[model samples]
Target: MLKGQPRATSPRPAISPAPGASEVFQLLRDGQPRTRAELAQLTGLARSSVASRVDTLMGLGLVAPYGGAASTGGRPPSLFALNPGARAVVAADIGATHARAILADLSGRELAEERQALTIGDGPDAVLGWLAGTVGTLLARGGLPASELAAIGIGLPGPVEHRTGRPINPPIMPGWDRFDVPARVQESYDVPVLVDNDVNIMALGERSFHWPGTTELMFVKVATGIGAGIISGGSLQRGAQGTAGDLGHVRVAYGGEVVCRCGNTGCLEALAGGPALVAALNERTGGTLTSSQDVIELVRSGDAGAVQVIRQAGRDIGDVLAACVNLINPSVIVIGGSLAQAGEHLLAGIREVVYQRSLPLATEHLRIVPSVAGDRAGVTGAAVLAIDHVLSPESIEAACAALTTG
Candidate 1:
């Protein structure tokens, strides 16, 4: 959860800095309702101040009364909770070969969802058009009007300039180089549009959904392309280039002969991504596998050749992650994406190398596990991004002010 604002100083308690609407909203965001006295005690604000903030949030439909709480004495104070039905958020996870769209309430509950076989190479116009249409379909499914939509979040399978929501020199996305994804999507639905790397959002989703308590975490996606979403000190780190987690393109000491899609040699992706794993299995199993799904099924069926290939790929990935462990030392490392569906084979290989090579201290308490969200991690994370955007302190304050004036 995001932190609240600083308190104002005054001589009288009545004039003490009241909690801002955003601050109060954050407290209620957990779906727990509290009386104004409880809020004042927690925030050290005056009862009057808390009431003002509550009234502001209620004005915008962001908070509502949740009936009464058991009173210690006198009349019971009214309990207020987050009003999740105020508006819906649209989330899209666009991959190399497919896309997923979902509508979620402000509280991050999925209202409706749809998946489709959309190609990235289809360019921004075609892809954005389809996504917009999908958003409309979801709105209809949820019985929501366009006006009920508050924000749109997208997770693209490439590096994204988060400030502008544009893809930056993505290797596989042919026509999306520096394309303004948010602006394009905003054309259809004029709302706050957020965009980020698919793995970054996956990391956000994994953390928010499964490990909200863990502060240091890493989400590694091992599909056609490979990347990592880093959460350091409870915040997602994109670094200076928004490619902070491009683990796939990291050079491998032993794979100098391998060519990567980024026109580089010896990248981890070139050696261990899903496509690379499938290709390796074909060499051993006489070309029986084609897609990442094929690789997963083969591994599940206990095919020795496929298992060996995936384990090797995991080892290669672990080689990169070992370095990450030593450098960042995240407590939780979640392996996600289609390849992760192969289960323990990949995790075993990664754990084997990560534990063996990483520093003892770094490896001691580290837990590398498969993703909980599975195939839906991307979409889940996308929704989280939008939810965070709308619920952010600054955004909440601004939106409430707008509503108050309107």
Candidate 2:
């Protein structure tokens, strides 16, 4: 079943007393055909109330009647399910080097997508403008009208104030500190917007799409920067300042002097990040190599120099994550990003240190693997986030009222 977006407020949303509409909707959303009698029994509401809620959902075009279910003795009752085509959300994954967007339905199914090479360092105005155009082109390609859009979800490669949908002192993303990203994106369309950390959204995608029922997971991205996405108890754990998984800035146990982007010396990112690895290789072999892609290809072709560097880099990452594993006790550790495409060499090094250093209990059930979704994880997670936000009980109540009044 597709997950619904929960309210981001302190107090939980109020229950819809009228026929348990939200409850009924969730029942139908489970991708199974359910009868009013079954819903009533499950929800402890009257059959009449269940029927009323179903009527409201159908009226709003949120639910559709499917073929009938077999009956015990009487005539079979009709079944209902969520209408995936009722509304769509725009999902954007903005990286340091490129931007991608997708048009997805309420069920988190992608209908259209587009990508372009652009740098986040170009600042918000230029990037967001480009983003707006990219979204427009994608919507056109999908044959979807902007009027059908319910919300927008974006993942930026930096810390974000999730509440206001703004970046907060992003080191790599210049001129984006406290930028009104949601407002800028929403200007073209009147809809709710959700902005969050790119890695966090990637973790969400892994959990929601690839590994359902995984309540505890960690997504470590080894790219131009080294960062982690933390999921504890089936929810993303954004710390007090929305930088819980800012693993790049962690101090290495033993490292040579190298200044980091955050102005720290001997930081993990400065020592073992993609840029650091690439610089080390280029300096040693007197070869000019740019981007993590080059390093990934070298490792893929079994270059001893590249393989050795990546293996050491993975060990360095594991050094930091060993502590994290002890603290978080995640069952799964998923390594992603461009450098992760180097495959087993990286994984082997990470495994060596993680298992050697972490507690026996922690390592017993831990499973370290590569991301199956790859680059698409962030956008897919963003799409799911948008759909969930628009389908929350509060939003659903408002939508139902609008449908009934109209």
Model 2 has a clash total of 0
lDDT of 2 by residue, 1-406 (tens): 5343321213223333353478788776656667788888988998888888877776666777666688888888876778777778899999998988999887787888888899999999999898788878878988888888889899999889888888999888879999999889878777998999999999998888898889999999888788899999998899987889988899997976789878879899998898899898999899999978898998888899999999999999999999999999999999998888999999999999999999999999899999999999999889878987888788888887665455
Worst 10 residues of 2 by lDDT: 5-14
For candidate 2, the lDDT comes to: 0.86
Q: Against the true structure, what is each candidate's TM-score? A: 0.93, 0.92
lDDT of 2 at 46: 84
Full-model lDDT for every candidate:
0.87, 0.86
- Clashing residue pair totals per candidate (backbone < 3 A): 0, 0
Tens digits of per-residue lDDT, candidate 1, 1-406, equal: 2122112212222222223678878898887777899999988988888898887777676777776789889998887888788789999999888999999998788999999998899898999999999999999999999999999999998889999999998877889998888888888899999999899999999999899999999999988888899999999999998879889889988997799877889999999987788788788757866799998998899988888889989999999999999999999999998888999999999999999999999988999999998988889999999999989999987876675456
Identify the candidate with maximal TM-score: 1
Candidate 1 off by > 4 Å: 1-19
